[model samples]
Target: MENITFNHIYTLGNIVFENEIYKHYHYPEMLVRYDSNFLAFKKMPSIDEFKAAFTYLRNYHMKHGQSHVKFTFPENQKPPEGFLEYLNDNDFLYGYNELYEIQPDQFPRLKDNPDININPVTAENLDAFLTLQYTFDEEYGEEFAKQKVALHNRNFKDEQIMQVLAYYRGLPAGSVDIIISEDTAEIDQLSVLDTMQRKGIGGRLQKFVMDHFPQKTIILVADGNDTPREMYQKQNYQYVGFKYECIKVFE
Candidate 1:
């Protein structure tokens, strides 16, 4: 099989990343998806241009009714000369400090992270997961929870929304999902509630997931959670890349 280079994927007709890499073109374009972390990209547009890109991308995904987003930078080189200023002017948020990626191969054992009793959850545990999602949201997602509730009510004989669930101290603590792609698995909706902060419940569950699927590469987006991000780093996963906050504004 031919290796799908990032450039080749652009032949699908997307050229935002490579186009921005060129110094000559000031074309500010972006690629975004909100189902994951919110992220944005663009050439060196003006401060307003950056803001527009930032807002536009976020707005697009918001219309999709996504809850959150994360922006990431892809580079092996040192930080750009004016990267911070550019980000600040554009409302692009980052961590309290520099961010890093984490892997489970390095931190393989869940026994060390925390005592999360992990398992593959099914219809039996759907309601519990929704309850957890209800508490995880900043401003309670009633509508989102309605959507989640509808998900729980699904009775698909042939096809259904796939999910994974984990229990911490015999209660639901975290989860990652099985997505649409056959080969690539998207880690969706991993949450460790505020009441359970600093317990390492999320870590142990993630370890169990990684250990379960050794052949697969895990991809998840971390928000402002330092513990989760730190846990990922201690495990040795480097930041492969990030997506943009995708939004489409009304003309």
Candidate 2:
């Protein structure tokens, strides 16, 4: 986060977490976030320090107790060959993958199903949305959701978070956050919790947004292998580009 222009919610600054060992950021729900490419640590690491660094990361996740925190290292800063093994030893479900950007038209045509009833994420339904988000993560990205919620609850704004918690039939089923930067509207952080999957909730949620916003270009990040890619492709979204998930070494 150093040398970058952004509104940081982390008082420890956009550097490391309070303990100094775990480096992270509190991303607003709708806004796209990226590391400044500024190294979280001072230098490339020696093998001896790898254990301690991974330990710190593990503790960092435990301390925060929820939500997945991502540390982006430069593509050139390689970890020791056994680094991922170290993470596995600590029960970290680590997977390296691509972040694909899909366009709206590519997503499926809405069944326009009657099973779904979409609504705004107001303060009255925040807890439901949060709970729904938890269930969603548990089903699809349980561990990742834990870290994400933990970090999100502690470090993000109530209103901003609500913006990502739109309701469906009085239950928190899914959400798509909207952000206006300069002249463009960025659609992001869309999530449909578990128990609601395949219920047409996601399509309904987004379709409602499109109904209100027909001319806007919706944007977001999805795992290259996530099944949601099929959904996005059905939404008429073209693959504009991609963002790499590189390793961020803090040594």
For each candidate in turn, give its C-alpha RMSD to the true structure in angstroms: 7.8, 7.9
lDDT, residue 212, model 2: 49
- C-alpha TM-scores of all predictions: 0.55, 0.52
Alpha-carbon local distance difference test for all models: 0.46, 0.48
Q: Per-residue lDDT of 28-139 in model 1, one digit per residue for the tens?
A: 1222222223332433344455455456545654665544444433322323447565655545444322233233365555445345666665667767766765565425
Off by over 4 Å in 1: 1-107, 112-116, 138-162, 180-183, 198-200, 223-225, 241-251
Residue 56 of model 2 has an lDDT of: 63
For residues 34-144, could you state the per-residue lDDT of candidate 2 as single tens digits? 332112433444445545664565465445442343443332244555765655565544343233232344445555555567665565665666676666556544655
TM-score of 1: 0.55
Clash number by candidate, in order: 19, 35
Give candidate 1's whole-model lDDT.
0.46
Per-residue error at 152 for model 2, in Å? 6.0
lDDT of 2 at 123: 57
